[model samples]
Target: MPSLVAPLMSAGCLAGAPQPSLPVEGGLLLRPWRLADAAAVVRVFQDPDIQRWHLKRADTEAEAREWITRWQQGWQDEVAAHWTVVDADSDAVLGRVSLQSIILMGGQAEISYWTAPWARGAGVCSRAVTAVAGWALSEAGFHRLELGHSVVNPASCRVAVKAGFTQEGIRHNALLHTDGWHDMHLHACVR
Candidate 1:
């Protein structure tokens, strides 16, 4: 019988990857999510702005804990890297940022983020995203990082721009929110 192992090995299908580490950006620290963050996650998701954009709601502590667990699993699976955006000085949870849909073989990933209500209007998301993008491009050796947001969310668009992501174009009817399908503005940054 012909061996399949030779083909797989030649294709680089068995390459090992490294785990991601927490990144610090001045006042903000991008650290792994913990069960202790459940309360903060619940509170942040309860905000109307977060609910309107993200669609997924975590109203209870249990659901928030589950969300944290999923992030942990994503790390183990090498599919995503999620960070709880926290204030370095106070260690207070300010929001979250993630490098999702990570394809190490392709050297690309997508970024997503949300800021706590109290943390909004202060460029928290923008700074956090910029730091993560720098890490992804330089340390992680990723060539491209993408971000998209509902066109209706101008705030997110501004964040993307401030973080150095170039606006690419619109994806028509890309996201399905509670209201309905909405167009999304695609953005990207290249190393």
Candidate 2:
């Protein structure tokens, strides 16, 4: 039997158009990843803090290329969208921001990000999140966007709040990192 609810967004609403490069406050812009970014990708993943926050690491240029392939495929499949946050003037990557687990029919997605070691403590991640959230809510037509972070990471909590996502609650043992399972603080914003 079919459910009574209507989907908030159309299936092709996102994939129908090319992904956009968003220029936010600060000197950052969110642009699609390229294979040429392989070296930078590997370098960023080598950071201990990045590895701790995001389990996987790209050790080689080939591995970074594969990651880029997946990100591009995700956009075509309309399942997710990944953007490399870069210096708008120089086009050098400062970090990355992504809309993961996108459900276009439901008008919802989850946001994730990591900053390059050099960009840390300079508010790059928060600025990227703010840019992506604004686009997802206003232009892309998503009804809600969620940001989840391990409760142990206060920095992510600060980023989420600074990006305007309200803390909803915690999910018990929601994420499994290399250390062990962790409770996640769930934050969200609705259009």
Would you estimate the TM-scores of all the predictions?
0.89, 0.97
Superposition error at 35 for model 1 (Å): 0.7
Q: Candidate 1 lDDT, tens digit per residue, 1-191?
A: 87543321122221255344455656778888889999999989889999999878998999999999998788777678888889988889998889899776667789999999999998889999998899888776778999999999999999999999999999999999999999999999999
Worst 10 residues of 2 by lDDT: 3-12
lDDT per model, in order? 0.85, 0.92
Residue 156, candidate 1: how far off, in angstroms? 0.2
Candidate 2 residue lDDT tens string, 1-191? 78588888888787898889999798888999999999999999988888998878899999999999999889989999999999999999899899999987689999999889998998999999999999989988899999999999999999999999999999999999999999999999999
lDDT of 2: 0.92
TM-score: which candidate is best?
2
